[model samples]
Target: MNTQSYMTSYEILVYTGDKRGAGTDSNVSITLFSKNGKQTGKIPLKNSNNKDPFERKQVDKFCVKGDYIGELTKLHIEHDNSGRSSGWFLDKIVVTDIFDPKTQYVATCNQWLAKDEGDRKISRDLTLHKQQTTTQKSNYYKVTVYTGNKSGAGTNSDVSLTLYGNLGEAGPMKLANQEDNFEPGKKDEFTIECQNVGELNQIFIAHNNKGLSAAWFLDSIVIEDLYAMHTYQFPCHRWLAKNEDDGKIARFLVPQSSTTETPQIRKHNQYKVTVFTGNKSGAGTDADVFITLFGNQGQTGQIKLDNEKDNFETGQKDEFIVECPAVGEINKILIEHNNKGLSSGWFLDRILIEDTQGHRTYEFPCNRWLAKDEDDKQIARYLVPRPKVKNNQYKVTVFTGNKSGAGTDADVFITLFGNQGQTGQIKLDNEKDNFETGQKDEFIVECPAVGEINKILIEHNNKGLSS
Candidate 1:
């Protein structure tokens, strides 16, 4: 158990000016400073969520880690005018503590980070609110690098890694903890400040290809982003030695979410709900529709389903995505429409729900009319999952040849054979005669599907009299 995991996190919201060309493609950097002279490294600011970032009127969410730096008093921001139209107009910056949202610091820097802008300077230092106080502290990150056990797995070269995420990148941070840092079949741990890299994605690890054992077999790298409370795993399991692995001294390893990896705690979960309408006539509805899901733990608030130019049409599957707090095993769903009066019912065939966090799918079948004048006259219904069949009910049809004595008077039975197994012999009984000449008889039987129907066997008791 690491006590560093309990450190608080700060959220930075950057607003791009609404003016045209206010967005920038250039690299942006920032540093946090306390009035007591404590300051963080110049952390690179990049948002992975936005491919074309810093767009006009856009707000980017980033998490910044603070090392004991209490009551932030100011921050230094700068951007390199690199890419096309890289001029960036600076709006106000709002920083808040994740643990205490009410504790906020507003730095209003209405300037530009462009060569041709106001001061022709690409950097500015903005102070916090006039009423706030400041102090000094620094955040720490625990980095563990593993050396492979293979022959000549250790490296004598200098190893460095840069943390990349939506918030920023902190590094090329040298991995020079001790003289025997990269020893084969060994692990080294070092604690450094990797101030908030929101949603850690990719990591760049490499060596300078120096020393006696410059070619090293790297196993993996693990970094703790206590600000986001996630331990990210960047598995290499390859050679970073120049003479090995395509003779490359560096490897860009992305984060893995395998069973061994610890995922970041998510505040909200997204659900994809698809409502299928019956193919029958008058199956669609014009009024707004809503649904509420009930699970073992709790229930979701009523959410409206609306998408596309037209939705909930006859013989159509209307899909909608909604985000809410995670719930337990889903058991039931409530679906209804606001439409009343004549012929306004919606014939819902079923509803399918998929939960990404739980990796479970739920199906609720309601093959009926949801109208005020139909069924039970109730427009709403609570439908539980009626599928995921443990046993399949198949309607078997038997045709009697149109010839003399073609009908079977004796008790008839059938055993269906499939790839999985075979079903027990089931009696084929009906309301009318068992089977008449030129007549087709249908019977329903329930059994586990043997997979593919390869063959079937039929038998009779040969009892010619009534029971």
Candidate 2:
């Protein structure tokens, strides 16, 4: 009946090992932690009876008073390692709230907790454990990839496909096996385990542009979710190549159902895109150029800027038309080129996109290099409209686990992806000791607006402990 603080009581049931030397006369103590709040100080365990607790093959029970801890999650238990039989072999501990009998937490630690035994650790931090009575069912799907039958339509590059749905996206699933896959007028089939993204909305297909003939003319893709009993089709009649139709390697395609409900697929808008190559020496490239527009309504995927005459010369202004759904207002655009041709370096100056249907224009200024060995060594560039849009500062909060050794000193970074574009890997560092065990760290990242973030990538270098 110790009265330091007593809002609730927890019944601690400790199980000692059945071995001959498992008995211990050492003083045992425990600290409890719960989801709602913390419990003040640790509680000593003893009995008024003539017999000592912690006997071999015995269940020692004790009642401790502490603060109201709702639904226990973890606890700290240790012995002073003082008595003659201090080298005890502990089995497990089960804690229950006396007020709320239904709330129980079990921690299994079948190891030696003595300085002279095991890892030579005298104390143990035990987390909540539960027996798994059932297995998690995995979602499996049948993926079919169809290649177009055009002149040199086959690609020798490695292809990756990702499926997106109302549930989420799955894969960068490899689409290659043996037998020289992705041949002209051919189809490749494979089975994959992906989370059942209910009612797929789109598919993102791409290639690394490697190998000898890395140009791919993808015709269509069909996926059957065996668990959900649903089928989704993504039709693509274009080329995913660095030098082909779009000079782009990545693409996002919506399912047939989405296009069917888009009022009418024929009721699309055409956007006139004007590209100006930098006037400097070797500023122009023969590489295929592509663009994707993002606005208030939505975004259009990569569109190729193709023309009859030789385009993208020194200080050349090339114009092309792109047709898609009406993007309400102009926001930004992603411009890039395939590192093709003998001289594949190109410096882009600026871009102007005119919405023919909406009668609005958006200008994105680049004035940078998109070469493999030049400035930034990036072939792709994301530019906002003219007038130089200011950067967006996003407050990002990260929660580190509360378990043992859940903190790290490694440099952490995060990347955010949305319907518009993605942000680069921004470091998550501050003046404080961040990422401590069970710590909530907040960081402000200043970057362009990645409109409507869809995915966030979090990672850290493995230089530190328990990253």
Instruction: State the C-alpha lDDT per candidate.
Output: 0.74, 0.75
Put down candidate 1 lDDT per residue, 300-384, tens digits, no spaces: 5555576655888899988887755455777888898778434578888988786745534567878999887677877789999
lDDT of 2 by residue, 1-467 (tens): 65745475566789988877887888988898876666547888775122778888788876566686566778888999998889888899988654444446799889888888889887898997633322222467888889999988998888888775533346778876676789999988978886555456556788998988889898888888664445777777888887776477877675555335553222346677888989999898888776767777676655557777799898889888665555677777878776889778899998877665443455778999999999889998889886533468999999999988888998887877788665555778778999999999999877657689999988887765555
Worst-scoring 10-residue span by lDDT in model 1: 130-139
Candidate 2 accuracy as lDDT = 0.75
When summed lDDT is taken over every stretch of 10 residues in candidate 2, the lowest stretch is 129-138
Each model's TM-score, in the order given?
0.31, 0.33
| Clash pairs (backbone) in predicted model 2 | none
